[model samples]
Target: MSWSIRIGSIAGIRLQLHVTFLFFLAWIALSQGLLTGHAERAL
Candidate 1:
């Protein structure tokens, strides 16, 4: 959990973004861009 950054809180519960989740997101975007052939689509 040390790799996660605190994002915010919701109703006393904390939210965080893990480092692996970021990489997973990047992978998704890259795959989408490759499939669509549109770099802007990755954003």
Candidate 2:
């Protein structure tokens, strides 16, 4: 399923990324880092 929508662009450049997917990725990385006792690198 397509979870991302081509929001917009500028100067002929194309931008693509699912909002939720991006957030989900961030959450995963942060959580993993925190759980691994590396909270300083969570972001």
Candidate 3:
């Protein structure tokens, strides 16, 4: 029973990390796009 609980916790942690990484990746892409647009406007 304890082993099953530990495995569940580990799976949850992995899922959380995956979600965090995806969020950051999306944020970086959005920021990059905004910066590129700003640079074009300046030019």
In TM-score terms, which candidate is top? 1
- Candidate achieving the largest lDDT: 1
lDDT of 1: 0.90
Clashing pairs in 3: none
- The sequence of per-residue lDDT tens digits that candidate 2 reaches over residues 1-43 is 8777787898998777787988998899889998999967888
In candidate 1, stretches whose alpha carbon ends up further than 4 angstroms from where it belongs are: 39-43
lDDT of 3 at 7: 20
Clashes of each: 0, 0, 0
- Report how far off residue 29 is in candidate 3 (Å): 0.2
**Ten-residue stretch with the least lDDT total in model 3:** 1-10
Tens-digit per-residue lDDT, 1-43, candidate 3: 1222222345356322344566777777777778888533332
lDDT of each: 0.90, 0.84, 0.52
Which 10 successive residues of model 1 have the least lDDT summed?
34-43
| Candidate 2 worst ten-residue window by lDDT | 1-10
- TM-scores for candidates 1 onward, in order: 0.68, 0.53, 0.45
